[model samples]
Target: MLYWFFTNPVSLSRWADKHAEGRKLFFKCLYLFTAFLGIAVAASGAVESALAWMPRSWVRYDEDGESEWIASSIAHVAGFIVAFFVTLKGAELATRIRRLEEESN
Candidate 1:
């Protein structure tokens, strides 16, 4: 896993090279990657901000007599879920890139 982690840039470079060298739909794919990354960052940042603010007691709590802020908690988890999908999208992109790299080799 660590090895794979370290080698990601090489794969990314090759993928970018393929795109730069006249592959069609390059901008389309790049736009999707940018959008996904933007969404992932926004979602994760919102979750982090919410969790950080929770300690200040500014979050709303459910009226069921528990101190747990149920709605905010759910939102945090949903934010992470959205971020996780973006990560999965990245993995899928890497796999497709690797396949294309292999095919070209």
Candidate 2:
């Protein structure tokens, strides 16, 4: 399996350099995608935080919020896990882009 999440900055730099040019549309699209993922990560985190603080009664489906809590909690955790990798990816891509820019100088 390609453990892209485990790749080092050097590998990321190499990948960026291999992408035809330093500032191609691919890079632009990647940057934009990471930016959006950042927003989603933030939103997911906020939702988790809010849910944590809110009263259990807010869900209002069952007498107890157990089911809703479990579902939302699972979703929140999943969101965080995904966010962790994507955040790393974004940072890696940004570092690679910077490396490419430096190399072109």
* Candidate with best lDDT: 1
Name the candidate that leads on TM-score. Answer: 1
Per-candidate TM-scores read: 0.42, 0.40
Give a tens-digit lDDT track for model 1, residues 1-105. 334323353444455566566753464355446656666668866776666645546555557766765446656667768966875676577668868878999
TM-score of 2: 0.40
Give the alpha carbon lDDT tens digit for every residue of 11-62 in model 2: 4445556765756556545654665576567767776776676666555255
Backbone clashes per model, in order? 0, 0
Model 2 spans with C-alpha error above 4 angstroms:
1-68
Clashes in predicted model 1: 0
State each model's C-alpha RMSD to the native: 10.5, 7.8
Model 1: lDDT of residue 26: 61
